[model samples]
Target: MVLYLQYNRGMTPTEAGQIMMLQAVMMTICAPIAGRLSDLWGSRVLATVGCLIIATGLGILVQVNDRMPLVVIAGSMMAIGLGHGLFSTPNNSTAIGTVAAAKLGIATATLNLARQCGQLLGTAVLSLLIAIFFDGRSITPQGYKDFQSVAVWALSISLAFSLMAAWFSSRKG
Candidate 1:
């Protein structure tokens, strides 16, 4: 959406590129810190907090509009990057650490496979939602609005799931 809007406004790709770069930089900076923190604090707390942060970013993203500022978009991206950085390492460590040494390879493979499958499924679902919202219309302002509505709905659902994950993570084991 940002790319589309930026293109329409005759802005160069530099702005979009910068936003992406910012996200990458944030992830790079936060990942190791989060990993260390997770080691100190435990995976449950870090992962739950990460999920909540991601949910917050997505919730903010639902409000994206043509009138929205670039700073807001960049900030949202940074939040998402930070959240993922904080979530992934600890979650993986927790999963792998919980299993027996003999099952380590299997556990690692299963974790990676699940991650890929989730990504694929999420992409497909979001794509379907976008198509449904488009309703075969060209990309107009109204179409963009419709897409935004679908995005909001999708993000809201994701947020609910994230909250659920957080809750589950918080439970006594």
Candidate 2:
């Protein structure tokens, strides 16, 4: 969110709005298909593939600067969105399956807490980096390039983590 604002600083609000809208469309279109594929093929393959694709997408996204190229941005967004689609259901299923029905509430709470903590940590770290590097500038072509690069780095790390998770999930009975 902060990256989006900083990187696109020079753009009109309408342009920024359009980019966000495009992101929404891309996610909506790809998510369900990815989820369904995961259901059919198994999470191990889907999650691993999804993580790799998403990392590639983030790589592409980081390279885009100046005008928000719809093609590249949309493509990257779709890739990550599809990955989330693939990972979410199966990952949740595995976690849920690990607990008894009686303890499901506690399991879900723990999962939710972990997710929230991750989100908070990511947001804080990224926002701080963007502020320090960009000097609190609004989204400009150069700013976007810089922010996107960092975002890509973050995504790559996430993909590695996802791969590890998939590996562990596969080992379960």
Whole-model Cα lDDT of every candidate shown, in order = 0.76, 0.64
Candidate 1: deviation at residue 9, Å? 6.5
**Candidate 2 lDDT score at position 113:** 97
> What is the Å distance of residue 167 in model 1 from its true position?
1.7
- TM-score of every candidate: 0.84, 0.70
Task: Enumerate residue pairs that collide in model 1.
Answer: none
Candidate 1 C-alpha error for residue 122, in Å: 1.3
Over 4 Å off, model 2:
1-9, 21-40, 134-173
For model 2 the local lDDT of residue 148 reads 65
Which runs in model 1 stand beyond 4 Å of their true positions? 1-14, 140-142
